[model samples]
Target: RPAYIGERVVTPRTPADPTADSDKVVWSQTVSLLLGALCEKSWDTEKV
Candidate 1:
């Protein structure tokens, strides 16, 4: 009988942030930017 194929192995490994535990901070920053754009509150506003 012939040998069967096994699971594939990856090389070089995938890039990642080992220190990150969750995406809470990322989502928070995204939401903040969205709110700012919706309210037209940017750093270059001259209507202050």
Candidate 2:
């Protein structure tokens, strides 16, 4: 769920960086999604 949400948030920023190449921009969003997922996973795990 956080992956999906983060993807939505990051998707817009992905194309916003005109200074960066397309591949780099895409990679940024991928990283963002991964981080978001990790954060959510950690939070959920801590609750148990």
Best by TM-score: 2
Model 1 TM = 0.39
* Top-lDDT structure, candidate number: 2
Sum up the clashes in candidate 1: 0
Lowest-sum lDDT 10-residue window in model 2: 1-10
lDDT of 2 at 22: 57
How do the residues 1-48 of candidate 2 rate in per-residue lDDT, one tens digit apiece?
346644544455556665565555577789878999999999999998
Candidate 1 runs further than 4 Å off? 1-22, 41-48
Candidate 2 lDDT for residue 20: 60
CA lDDT of every candidate: 0.47, 0.69
Mark the regions of model 2 whose C-alpha exceeds 4 Å error after superposition: 1-20
